[model samples]
Target chain A: MNDASSQDPEQQSMPPLGADHPSVARILRRWRQLSGGRHTRDPDRKTLVACSGGADSVALAIALAQIPSSCVLAHIQHDMRTPEQAEHDRAYVEALAKRLGVDCAFGIAAVSEEPGNLEANAREARYQELARIADEHACPYIATGHHADDQLETLLMHLMRGSGTRGMSGMRPATPLGNKTLLRPLLEIPRNEIETMLRELDIAWCHDQTNDDPAYVRNRIRQDLLPLLRRLDPEIARHASQWSQDLVAMQEVMDERVEATLMEPCTITDSQWRWPRELLQAHPDIMLGYLPGLYCLRVLDNEGADRITRRAIDSWIRSVKSDSNNPTEHRIGPIVAHIRAHEVRFTPAESSELST
Target chain B: MNDASSQDPEQQSMPPLGADHPSVARILRRWRQLSGGRHTRDPDRKTLVACSGGADSVALAIALAQIPSSCVLAHIQHDMRTPEQAEHDRAYVEALAKRLGVDCAFGIAAVSEEPGNLEANAREARYQELARIADEHACPYIATGHHADDQLETLLMHLMRGSGTRGMSGMRPATPLGNKTLLRPLLEIPRNEIETMLRELDIAWCHDQTNDDPAYVRNRIRQDLLPLLRRLDPEIARHASQWSQDLVAMQEVMDERVEATLMEPCTITDSQWRWPRELLQAHPDIMLGYLPGLYCLRVLDNEGADRITRRAIDSWIRSVKSDSNNPTEHRIGPIVAHIRAHEVRFTPAESSELST
Candidate 1:
């Protein structure tokens, strides 16, 4: 066979009646839209479903199975939980794939139990493993189980941490993971809806007991903050999720604009990036505010961008906008800006002087 | 004398020692920066202070009194409280103004005690009264005591309600009110710092017991949510406040761009506002999203814009951008969108179809 997908029979236009749940139809519609018609005509393509045997992922895998595209179930164990729980999850997922008559892949995550970053580390490990599995399966797309409630929680966490529009904009429906594309088909679907779908369809899903553990900040936010918010506004998650999607779209346009208008015109050498003073002054103040972060992200491309503060950006803007003939040097994250009369040059700061 | 402001003697570069609280100095510094050095050379300008007899406003009045520019304390009694409490507040404000050696104006607010809108009505009445007082006193600027905590609280309320960047941008430090300017010099200062300044300066201010009453949503947020956030992040208010300010600045740029790039180029007749189809297509998707809101705010200039939903905007964008362009009519808030091959036109909708 050319590939797993190429060997599969030509699928019918409509879903099979046995697998046609209303939630499945909705998920298929969203997947088609989010993938930009990738599902409509690309019959040879395959998607690796990252199922943790949760309601959300189980539903996603079920929905993708109804559509024409070939799908394989993939389960990853972070080993953060007890061995019994991890093994149980893997077995459940394997059974699910067998029931659906699809191939299955299982992998163990290599997560470092770092203090204060355990959750982040686990996530990184999981995604890394998912990418590796997708590569092995020759699946160009990896679908996940993230839903509207997850979107709302991420937004709340970002808001509490004083993140700007960038953080509050929430996750994208589709983003690249190494060479594979990561897809969240159920991002806009509410968690309760997914659960109801699984119940109505009589599909069993494994629930992680550790999800309620208060030790995790996300769990605390989910249990404490989300319920209180739901009490206040029943549609809080739906509204916040939609708003986050809008912000993501807006930020995409801004990133495009910044890349074309700012990053393109600037001259970059091995040691320094230079931009004409007039070019910097020509843009609107709002666009000017985006420069520092974009510089750190696109130019430096490292962890230094995370430490870049608003105060630093403001001070740098003030210096650039100032009508001073004298040379001035200001440190912004990992880079040091040298401002002169004609142009501004950015160079990597010395290792000893890299703070803020 | 020319005006209350022009009549006042030229002040010194530094504030008098007695009125020189660190918080006051910080407020003045922010005031100068926000005003674009308006306070540096413009010594002949007068500011009307809106004091509610609370610690925050009382401190504001005390700080402004030490400056050279004419300052007047204006207190508006909303009559929301009991007669005894209202009288007590007015009396306390008058006494504080006397202690500060500045002219004081007390006005009884004409507030409509609308069941659910009592707080909003009271606020509206107070601002109206402040504007009237400022106009009579020939004060070009009206200063209020909206500090960082209030900013954080506003952001939280907006986030809970799923507001876009426009709502979560927080309050501006300076905005035009009718013909006068409204200024919040203490916007960046923390609430506790203001209270500390009052205590250190031995300034007595009235206590509003109703602040602790959970009847008000803001009060509830203050009592329950803010404390929880504080326990999590001590600098939450400060960071969120700064982020809000950054959003406000970014929004200002967006507004300016929309006005120039989109609105200015569009054609508006007596009843219809029209834009070339190609012109709409030429702009970035982000700018297209802003077109509907800008049209409502600048073109219609009414409450219809407030009820406009994101879904409506998205559908409208899709309709306008679609290849099949038969004459189409869509209702957007209080406006009707008419899309044709050559141009898209917006006209006020019938009163019968005013609902979003």
Candidate 2:
């Protein structure tokens, strides 16, 4: 490590450090801190990186390769344009893997012929392929090259689409990718830093011309919306990304309550499922999270069920005084909970509830 | 109603039946449909309009006056600037009220010693005074001339401040204000309509010089940010307002869940409550909603608990799935939930849980 750090005067020009040459080391340190400083076992540590041959993924691959563990390159070939171009991408990733002495896996997926599901389908296919490869190789983790810029773009896209907290939270570092763990080590790293690393390494990467294609929503967001956001505040991308990270962190705390309160198995009856109402009443935030799914099911089951709106919940929560002990069941979405016989049971709406 | 409709040529020109009309009417219709088509007694059967004499407010007042309900005018004297200008506003509103054969009420509030809360304090005082007057004069509803443009500005401001769904939803049509209801019937109407209404009515109103003062956040949003948004999309304000309305609708649904799931009373025994682990395992969404408030309380109670994050929640929820039938207790936020004799209980953190 010391030899590598001392080898280049160009690396020496990086921000001052006692032993670590580049500021990237500090970033990696912070990444560990953010990851709670816990490293999994070697055999269990499997990562599948979504390599796009971009500066971001290239730099990520290089950094992960430095780690003393087996790493695999997972490249997705979205067959939207020329098949030859995708082949070129595979060749580049293979060459990079060859230089690093790591195994590379290339997946070519045909774009869906159906309309409207293009972006969603492509993303789903990419992750599915990565997960499949990881499973086949007995890899526990599937890594991605999504950087700060990507996170910020995701936040804004969700914001524009009028999403709530979960949508606004953006991408996470380690989330379940099917059966495998999807880790994104480069999420906090800026695009510029990744580009710099790629340049310093004298590595060439492919630039997807589709990135500028306004037809795609993500491209439009990248080319048009992001620039406008940057103009509003120069560091907006970084700030938005930070906000997203904070939200995700907050979401984790909320998820705990959900796990603690909502995951009880109940006997499903003809109309409703019996569960302890006290369990739900105890955790307010988790209950709010469960509303949408319940509401969706309720609406589907009973068309006339009153829409469980947000204001109604706020007012109802506010009305819950410290002294209130009455067991109450309010119709929210598809789920109805009523306190009867010393138990709160949640159930679907009756067919009569659906009659307009 | 026909007489009022015939009195205004612009009202006649309004689309008799078309979807192209600014989606406000459709939203109102949908709201009625949701509410079982039973008309709630118009609390604002006789309302006093808080006219800033600006285009937005003026438009709102004009539209409300067109309704069959009796209307009045109310103006607040901030006494911030020249007394003469304040008087001019009072006189303008009085004259407008006189022309419409509606009562007029005027009140003066002293500016706070500190200026940071100037806008908020002023608005609060104004509403308080309006409520008092509404009670005295038997006006069931107090109308504010906040139109679609104001709603859009409000939504943007909330978004910039990183507020959640509740904040981003913007002004509602009818929210309880003490005994009287605060109705913003014109929230769906655009600013252009107000201007057109004023011009058509030949009603000249004074422009508040303070509006040009960029010191206020609303003014800043109107002057600096809105134009940029318009440049990106000319109908940005309209779209934003519409989005706000849609979010308001969505939020109501979420709130219904919060009410039905959370808001249960639990007895505190020595400052600790143990919830049955099975309860949380049943409804994850409800539990998630309780996390934010719980996390906030945990931070106050124990500094070490600050480390409890969203990732923990995700892991904890996953853990619950594995621990089915076997009840376990987990400390989340300020509350602890566990199984004691197969009964779930949630209790506040005792001194020990708070201790580092």
The model with the greatest DockQ is 1
Q: Point out the worst 10-residue segment of candidate 1 chain A by lDDT.
A: A1-10
Backbone clash count, each prediction separately: 0, 49
True contacts kept of each: 0.36, 0.01
For each candidate in turn, the TM-score is 0.89, 0.60
Deviation from native of the Cα of residue B207 in model 1, angstroms:
2.9
Off by over 4 Å in 1: A1-20, A38-45, A113-116, A209-216, A282-286, A350-356, B1-18, B36-44, B113-116, B209-216, B282-286, B351-356
lDDT of 1 by residue, A1-356 (tens): 12223444543333343354778878877776766674355444478898988888888988877643468888888766788988898899888877666779988776655665666667778889888888888888889988999898887677667676688678889988888888998998888898998888888889954254334557768877777667666777777777777677667656666777778998988657799988997875557667777767666676588777666777888888887878888878777888999898887777325544
Model 2's CAPRI class is incorrect
RMSD of 1: 4.4
Query: How closely does chain A match the true chain A in each prediction, as TM-score?
Result: 0.88, 0.72
lDDT of 1: 0.75
Which digits, one per residue and each the tens of the lDDT, describe model 1 over residues B55-129?
Answer: 888778877776544678998876557889888888898887766567899887756556656666667777888
